[model samples]
Target: MSLIHALQSALGENAVLTQQADRARYEQDWRGLVNNPSLAVILPKTTAQVAEAVKLCAAHGARIVPQGGNTGLVAGAVPILGPDQVILSFSRLRAVRDVDLLSDTITVEAGLTLATVQQEAVKANRFFPVSLAAEGTAEIGGVISTNAGGLQVLSYGNMRAQVLGLEVVLADGTIWHGLSGLRKDNTGYDLKQLFIGSEGTLGLVTAATLRLYPPVATRASALVGIENIEQGLGIFTSIRHAAGNALTLCEFCTQPALSLGAAHTPNGRLPFIAPAYLLLEISALEGARDPREMLETVLMEALEKGRVLDAAIAQSERERLDFLALREAISEGELREGGAVKHDIAVSLSRLPALVRAVEDLVARTYPSLRPNIFGHVGDGNLHVNIRPPAGQTMADIANHKAAITRDVESLAISMQGSFSAEHGIGQLRLLGMAAHKSQTDLALMRAVKQALDPEGRLNPGKTIPES
Candidate 1:
């Protein structure tokens, strides 16, 4: 029988989607840049099914593109340049297998959305704080694979830290049952960490055991306008000093980002028309003192120190949602306005101001007329540097300039001992950047690991690790 026929026979008709329309949906990514569709879209319902499909593909020398919700910023979920590959999507395997409230951990299938996991935690009177705008759709497998760092990274760290264990299927169809909730394990290599941010190139994540936290009893959010990025950093330091671990998130938004939000999104409210902006949030556990009052006192101190020009604190839950709406709306607003060159990078907390100023100055001198939107989780030092050229410039123009801009910005980030791809994983988008930034020895070690895990190069090849 043919490879397609073998896959269909093993997975049944309902699990295999072979039509052009269905296959088309799996071709491109969120950015709509890469377009390499496949001959079939396999929806595996279990870890055995995933391993079986992968084994069959290996036997036939076929390539497999493992995917989750397809909400990736880079084109990592989509195929690179061939139509002969198979797009193995994990959407059908949505299942929460186990939840140990006493242990403060949950084991869920790869297809479960991050939002669903969060809801499950809430139902159990616990919390899962790794949140993003796409949490409603982005799946747990993709998040773990990408090691996504969201708004709460300042307090909770990234997905890597949140995951205690995982169930991964190797390239040769063997299942590695490392899904233990034990916090302390010095048995051997600690295999779970290898696949957490491997981007599915090393192994296919079937399920994961994630750490949980106590649910927040009270929360406070505010949008504070600062004179510049320096003041924003100062406020962050001051608030962290006052509230300690109670501080949940601290995001920075530039004037351009606020302007874009005000112009595009509905009900977009900019509290203060300052050069830079800061969005601060804090949450406290039950029986703890109200975090709102503490946050207010910190902001008041910032104002006294002349670090904050103006501020708007959320009075109700609805008001807090409105304030967050402005920050989340910036990306869509900027996209609607025109084309933009985007970068997800990180620098040291102490060096953010200098990095931002240097990059801004470099862009101004180089592009002359480009207005960049600089904003992200300032508490964690990750910033999304988006460049929007003046009106009438085609997207091609922006694409043409991506290399030069990326070089300058990435160099600056590297100089400060920061990551080139902070939240966004090193998909095909940053393969070249990886080469530029990473050392020869580092790249070789990564390749050796990839080869050791997926010897056939069938599991999401042409991603994460550069070509050997």
Candidate 2:
């Protein structure tokens, strides 16, 4: 039997997609930057089905691209090669296997969406805090595969923290069922960490054990206009001191970011005009005092200290979501400005200000016509520095300037001891960046691991670690 027939036999006809139209969705990425045409697309519902499909692909020596929700910014879920590659999509495995309330953990199949996991936690009166703007569509596998970090990371931590264990389907058809929920597991090597942010190069993730938290009874959110990013950092420090561990979010956006969001997101509105703004949130356990009063107090002091120029607290749940909508709508805003070179990078919290200043100076000096759309979880020093095209510029202009712009921008971030790829992970989009920046020693170690796991280089070929 042919590979497609073999896949169909292993996982019914409905599970295998072969037609171009049927495979189009898997071909393109969320950003439309990477397009990898697949010979076939397989959608397996169960872990066993996934394993069998992988074994078949390994036997055939055909390259496999493991995919989740396909919402990743870096084309991590999209294939790199055409025709010969098989897109292994995890869209059907949406099972919640176990929920241990006493242990504060849940085991779930990888294809389940992140929003569904959060809803499941809410149903059990617990909280799963690994969130993102793409949560509604982003699935557990992609979340674990990329080790995503989002709004509440300042307090709750990233996906890496929320994960207790995982079940991965290795590159060579072996299954590693290391799904232990124990908080203290001192087993040899801690193998799960290897696959957590491996970007599907080492293996395909099919399930995970995730941490949960007590539900928050009280919450608060505010959008504070600031003098600039420098003062935004100062206010962030002040708020962190005042809010302490209660500070769940401290995200910032420059005027360009706010303007972009406002232009694209219908719900987006600027409460005040300043050089920059910060969206903050605080949440507390049941019976705890409302966090609004605390944030308001901090905002008042921030205003008094010349850090915050203006501020408004969300008076209702709708208003709070609206405040978040403004921040979340940033990408939509950037879309209106035409093509952009996006950089999701992170520096030390203290060095973030210097990075931003240097980025501004460099962009103004180099890409004289373009403006930088800067916004992100500043509390964590991770920001999206997207160089959106200037008004009236053509696609050709963006194409002409992309290579040099990306090189210089990434160079600046590396100089600041910052990462070129943060939560987005290094997919095909950043393969060049990885080759350009990742050190030889690091690459060699990574290659050794890849060879050990996927010696044939059939899984996610030409991604994450650069080709040797």
Q: What TM-score fits each model?
A: 0.97, 0.98
Q: Which residue pairs show backbone clashes in model 2?
A: none
**Residue-level lDDT tens digits of model 2 in 1-468:** 788889999999999999999999998998877787887999999888888988999787688999899999888887776537999989899999999999999999999999999999999999999878889999999899899998888998899998889999987678899899999988689999999999899988999999989998988999888877788888788878877888899998998887777777775778889888889899989887679888888888777876678999999999888888888878855655565788889999888888888889988998888878889998889999989777877446779788888898888889989899888888888989998999999999999999999888888887898777
Model 1, runs deviating above 4 Å: 262-264
Please, what are the lDDT tens digits per residue for candidate 1 over residues 226-291?
A: 988899988899889888888989999998887787776577767669888998898999898788
For model 2, where is the 10-residue window of minimal lDDT? 331-340
lDDT of 2: 0.87
Q: Backbone clashes in each candidate structure, one number apiece?
A: 0, 0
